[model samples]
Target: SAAELLGDPAAYESMSQAANPYGDGRASHRIAEVLLHHFRGKPRPADWGGHA
Candidate 1:
């Protein structure tokens, strides 16, 4: 299935620049922030740790 999907040249290019359904490539940063908020028991600002 993976090979079939990637084998289509047009499909490959289309998928490359597709908008991320999640929070872009900054998902890890967002996840870390949520963890920190839960552990610290407070609403931390977006800039709490650093830039995403």
Candidate 2:
């Protein structure tokens, strides 16, 4: 499978450039803010400035 995929330039490029479904690995930051707000009454930080 790996060799087949690598051999096809178009397929490899398509897969390499595809958008990631998960939002830029900032999920932990949001989760931390939520937990802090819930447990310590701290204000949640401003929205993470990231592309949708």
Candidate 1, TM-score vs. the true structure?
Answer: 0.38
For candidate 2, report its TM-score.
0.47
RMSD of 1: 6.2
**Could you give candidate 2's per-residue lDDT for residues 1-52 as a string of tens digits?**
7896779998888877777877667788789998999899999777776753
Q: After superposition, how far is residue 47 of candidate 1 from its true place, in Å?
A: 9.7
Those runs of model 1 whose alpha carbons end farther than 4 Å from true positions after fitting are 27-52
Question: TM-scores of the models, in the given order?
Answer: 0.38, 0.47
Q: In model 1, what lDDT does residue 9 have? A: 82
Candidate number of the best TM-score: 2
Which numbered prediction scores highest in lDDT against the true structure?
A: 2
The CA lDDT of each predicted structure is 0.69, 0.81
Clashes of 1: 0
